[model samples]
Target chain A: MWSGWADIMDPHSLTKLNQCRRERRAAILLTDLGDGSDRVIVEGDAVDGALGDAVANAFRSGKSGTREVDGRAFFLNVHLPPPRLVMIGAVHISQALAPMAAIAGFDLQIIDPRTAFASPERFPNVRLDAEWPEDVLAREPLDAYCALAALTHDPKIDDPALTAALKADCFYIGALGSRKTHARRVERLTAAEISSASIGRIRAPIGLAIGAASPAEIAVAVLAEIIEALRSRGVGAERGKAA
Target chain B: MSQTMQSAPPKDPLTIAEEWLKDGKEVAIATVIETWGSAPRPIGSHLVINKDGLFEGSVSGGCVEGAVVTEAADVIADGKPRLLEFGVADETAWEVGLSCGGRIKVYVERLG
Candidate 1:
């Protein structure tokens, strides 16, 4: 009987049988082998086999998988958003503000032409650039997640940055100055052809009027204002409350 | 381009909580939910506690951690959330060395 069984199962037939066994373990089956002229026939329980095939295809294509288990198809998708920030100064306020912003989920960068002010030691954890504002900002594209703040209080340092920030449509643009300083700066910017609406976008006297006197206190106020600005833009309340 | 992609390590409390969570441990998070005048930690400062009663953050200086950590351990073990409060009235405010006569309320939650 064994000899007869062996004779019935030839090498080609044995190979096909083994393949079928493997497919069955995987909840699928190959019903027919394809020749050059005909396609392969694969038949299995549609619920598991077809669904699994769809999921595999989706995974291979880097897309959300859709599979009907009973009568419902479940879709799975994953999205990871990008990070952004724009600091238009390398002053003490920037030193304090950058790390605080990072704690609240911002990617901070400091831009200034004063090499002495912008250094690894001064901004130990932030990115620093010792370049002219317009030259540096022009190369980086701004988006909704981006925030721009000028803390230098010097027109040479702040004006070019304000121009770039206004042009790029950054979500937040704040400049650190007193009321008198802001009035003078606005005049200069208006003369430079910045629109009133764009000028209005700046939050000069850039804080919540918390009577902040120290560098750390001023840092807190600036971060608070930035959070409020971000909240108004609809990012959400939790982010605003983080710092 | 480089100016847009730099950031620092998170605040100590947040960083500690994240590290603990990533390590697959249940953590208890405590926050200074409310405060009056002259509290050391202020509102929103945090303290995180692990299952073993080990803590990685501070809600206040030496004055309040002992009580807060005890409460935190209870929270971690029982998985029940609770709010703890510490305060001083105007008369005894100087006892705890809280110079600014006021009160403070801390909210403690168990986070797995």
Candidate 2:
């Protein structure tokens, strides 16, 4: 007997089953019937037993269904939110910046090769990747909303991530270094064939020149710069619309 | 019932009245309704005093707390609200230490 019980009832599967069984709850999907007109129709309880199969059948047959409960039909639009901040260091600044980013509605993830530095105790509420930046960041999509910061001064850590970030057109790419260090960084990137225009996109001194001497003060400066960049982008977008 | 007489956290003289009535305790709330010259606390400052002489949230520094608390306890026991004024100009005000020469009017209400 091939019953639904054959699969262990995980929360997701259980939710789907429960949604199908409840008459008041409806599963909505936009569909086009073969009549050249796209209209929504409610599914009945009989189709509940094969809800997953029905959805698959609709897609396979190029048709969709809109389930109705209490005369209201909702169309599901699966829009994924953007990728978040990908910090390439597990330093003290990252520790302070992670919580502030979380509060500002960022999905914060830290990537560092050092296992001791990326431990859970240091970053209690952040996602930690104990792999090198290039390996870890390669798994994630870097969209325009994505923020990538290279907090490590080491070329081994910063170089690979900066290369990836430049290729991806990440919205914000910042590297923490002194003026002299950034000069050396530019020379290194030039050797790697990154153009001056791409290098200009980086906030090399990493923060507003606030004379920050402590990790906490530096974190504030970095966040302030990020906020200013985001705001300037927004203003430019609005001006483009006015034109 | 007045709007301030609603049973909520004491916003003013009237709200404190309702809170005291609900708790079945004699209490006084002193509101800094008006102030002149350099005052330590601004207008709308509140100090709540119960019949037991316990209080919360300050209205002034050491200069006025003792006298305000005493006056508040008296108002709570009397079940009458009175506007009490004190400042550096008043002869007895020196005892309360408001020597900064600022005048303040406190509305003391028996919140019972």
Candidate 3:
């Protein structure tokens, strides 16, 4: 609980901050106007990365906030990475989801092992992980800002990704399927040892029941549901870096 | 190099500075670090400007963007960062910050 101004605007801190955003790391930049001491911290890292106790709460809440340390006021600007949408299918629906989600401000990644389906000609201008869904999730490891959508009705592709999403606890976990298909999915997942609670996290028959029939309409419904979940959180309440 | 591997466009305002820096251009970024009342843009919104007066994004919708861009050029040349404040000082200048009846504080910083 202290503060001071000690040349906080040095180029080093700003450079490191840019790296944090580039890497999509949740970070907080603490600026102490008292003596001008600036400190930066990336999530999962100690505030030691920050200059001092200026950022008392390394786990500070909210996108950003201001605090008074001693008599000096400190402005904490939290920069979370853009929300990531990881679609575990390169199906017709995904083509629509990709551009739509991008327009809504999500960083996109499509994961599918089916080479012909995952072809860039289909995904054009989208991030594609031709590797299996589990492998991509294992390598990338979804964060809170990530939303996982398993559109392939195939268990091999969708289940592993759904398992990964549940484990990662991403804010939104959606899977495309009819009720009958979803019931079978639940049994398969239960046999795979995924908890009912975790499986419950998925929004089955994913997307708002807009009675969507076409792939593009279904895409709109799904993207809308994702946005609803992302926005419905105390999320983006203020100056969150959600977008 | 497949299109799937093509990089997505930068979505964060902070990326502008990093991109312009790597492109070997003198750049300045004006960010809406704070706002009061009906400010147009939320905090962290940015307007990236180069020495050429070209800028991207918005800090105040249309109200104070021109002023911020003009000052960004000075920041680029002077290598100094400055805070800009804009809003209606009175009933007459309500056009200054627009009818939003709010004020915004933008921080303009020069980046290499």
Better of 1 and 3 by DockQ: 3
Candidate 2 residue-wise lDDT, A1-243, digit = tens: 122221111123323323432332223322111111111223322333343344434422322224343343312211113337888899999999888887877777788898988888898867888888877767764655577889989999989998888888766889999889999999999998999989988998998889888998898888877766644443444367569
Candidate 2 displacement at residue B66 in angstroms: 56
How good is model 2 by TM-score? 0.45
Between candidates 1 and 3, the lDDT winner: 3
Provide the lowest-lDDT 10-residue window in model 3 chain A: A1-10
Q: Which tens-of-lDDT digit does each residue in A1-243 have in candidate 3?
A: 334234325455667898887676777776654444666766655444233344434333335545665566666777777788999888999998999999998989998899988888898788888889877777668877799999989998898888888877787999999999999999999999988988887998999999999999999999999888876643333245335
Clashes of 2: 2
Query: How far off is residue A126 in model 2, in Å?
Result: 0.7
- Candidates ranked, most accurate by DockQ first: 3, 1, 2
Instruction: Give the winner by lDDT.
Output: 3
Clash totals for all models, in order?
A: 0, 2, 9
Q: What is the TM-score of chain B in candidate 3?
A: 0.79
lDDT of 1 by residue, B3-109 (tens): 34445634466456656666877677676656667778755466877777778677776566767788888777775556666666534334544444556666665
Off by over 4 Å in 2: A1-83, A234-243, B1-112
TM-score of chain B of each: 0.75, 0.75, 0.79
Model 3 segments more than 4 A misplaced: A3-7, A10-16, A30-76, A234-243, B1-4, B8-31, B35-42, B45-82, B86-104, B108-112
Better of 1 and 3 by TM-score: 3
Q: lDDT for each of the candidates?
A: 0.62, 0.64, 0.75
Candidate 1 runs further than 4 Å off: A1-83, A234-243, B1-112
